[model samples]
Target: MCLLLRLWPVLSLLLLAACDQNQVFEKNADFDSYTWTVQEKPAFEFEIQDTTQRYNISFNVRNASMYGYYNLYVKHQLFGPDGKPISALLHQMILMDPQTGEPRGKGTGDIYDHQFVALRNQQFRQPGTYKIVLEQYMRQDQLPGIMAVGVRVAKAENK
Candidate 1:
């Protein structure tokens, strides 16, 4: 029982690290300006290997607790291998509950982290280079309280 207790923390850390190692591609863009403007579209480029394999795609956003709104809207654009536009989508993400005003995601001090799934069980039509661009769609000319934005693509686990 003592041995199990001593090694439990180490074993748990290893298990958590192992779980996160399945990411096919991940990229994060930090906004040094501390503001996300409509013109300041952040782009992430990644290559696809196997078109047949399905993957889960999500957006990670970090914002301060003082973020004035309970939700955020973003415009997403995807470009294909030939540099042609593939799809354009408007995504609405809820950051906090409207009724309670309670925040979502892991928080430390004033900042919170949120992961919104943009695509699930999605497969690329072709194996090639792809580009994803994101822009804030809020009414403000320069949105505040946004710290960083990221994209994580992981291979789907067999069900």
Candidate 2:
């Protein structure tokens, strides 16, 4: 009885941490060479069952400290379930501080993880599977130090 009581707090915390009620979909695409090439485009498909709920879309990036540029550029396109393009844009994510060259986002040792918001309070028009494609948009043919890229869709909290 004493041991169970002592472990109750720890068990409660673990249970709470496992709950992510807002998460709809999250997936990552890893690069074997730790390099992202312009020709390599990663696409993610997720189903939208509820059109009334607003969602927040984010891009996840994991890079090494050796990444050459302070900012990463990419082009993202969203396609509806009917295979029609909905929106497309070129976005920039800051990975490091420009002046001090300090790496941004969550990091341990040399690796850093960044989550940049692509869309907030977004609602789907239709109920089906939607696709989002990400393409590296850089001057170089290949970008080094980029380990993986991912997409996350979650329910937006009402303010």
Candidate 3:
């Protein structure tokens, strides 16, 4: 009973550290075949319960070391709850260092994870469903070495 009591505080800290306090929505699409085709656009839909508060939107890219390009180009299209297009934009995310050619993400061996902030301090403006579609903008029809793609929406933190 003494040992159990001593470990309780450590165990509680671990559990609390694993929890995401500000995350509102997060989802991932895994590619079993490890390929992301241009036609296979992944769409992420999230609900906005409080439109008054601002949020930070981010994109998560998980790729293997075999990914050829040093950077990834993606096109994002956002739609409102009424199914109308809100905005569209293209973003370039650096995956590897240009000079050193070293991967620039958190990875154990070959697979690396990269998170790019797509939107910051942005208000949803509507308390309903919002959709975002992601498409690869590379010239190649199919992109390989991409294990998964994800979206994360979190409540903005005060500066």
Candidate 4:
């Protein structure tokens, strides 16, 4: 009984952390029944010094198994307070399978995982305001896949 009591608190904390940190994106406000298209283009815009650094965008997919393929992109210019774009960024995301033995482009007449994506700064130019876009191209729209993408603002490398 004593051991159980001690473990109870630990278990409770673990569960709470899992639920809280499991995702960064909220989907209820975003559509969940949309078909093979972006119901809404969700992106984050922020500014940073023009220097070299490695930036990473992490996306949380609610229905990871509901899609066959996924792709990510960035806007040419970021949204500004004046309701205009400030700069353009060419960043792309490459998705990877989280499921065991699940290959990419799977269920789309290929042998691969449902979808996966990742990106690095080397593939893009100097730091500036930008927009990240997530696109879906797949079959079976039973469950709408949810995604939350995060970008790290760092300096661009010196030439």
lDDT for 36 (candidate 2): 94
lDDT tens digits by residue: candidate 1, 8-52: 533553465468956877776878767777788899998898898
Candidate 1, residue 94: how far the Cα is off, in Å: 0.5
Candidate 1 vs candidate 2: which has greater lDDT? Answer: 2
Residues 1-159 of candidate 3: C-alpha lDDT, one tens digit per residue: 766653453354346435978888877788878899888889999999988789988998888889999999999999999999988899999999988889998766677777899988978878899999999999999889987888889899977
All candidates: CA RMSD in angstroms?
6.7, 7.2, 7.2, 10.1
Q: Each prediction's TM-score against the native?
A: 0.85, 0.88, 0.87, 0.37
Query: Could you give candidate 2's per-residue lDDT for residues 18-120 as a string of tens digits?
Result: 6978888887898878999888999999999999999999998988788899999989999999999999999999999999999987756677778899999
Determine which window of 10 residues in candidate 4 has minimal summed lDDT: 107-116
Which candidate leads the pack in TM-score?
2
lDDT digits (tens) for residues 1-159 of candidate 4: 756653453355346545753222222123445332444545655553333454433333322344444443433234444455444455443444445534343222221221222333432344454554444333333324432323333322334
Error of 3 at 73 (Å): 0.4
Ranking the candidates on lDDT from highest down gives: 2, 3, 1, 4
TM-score of 4: 0.37
lDDT of 2 at 46: 98
- Which residue pairs come into collision in candidate 3? none
Candidates 1 and 3 compared by TM-score, better number:
3
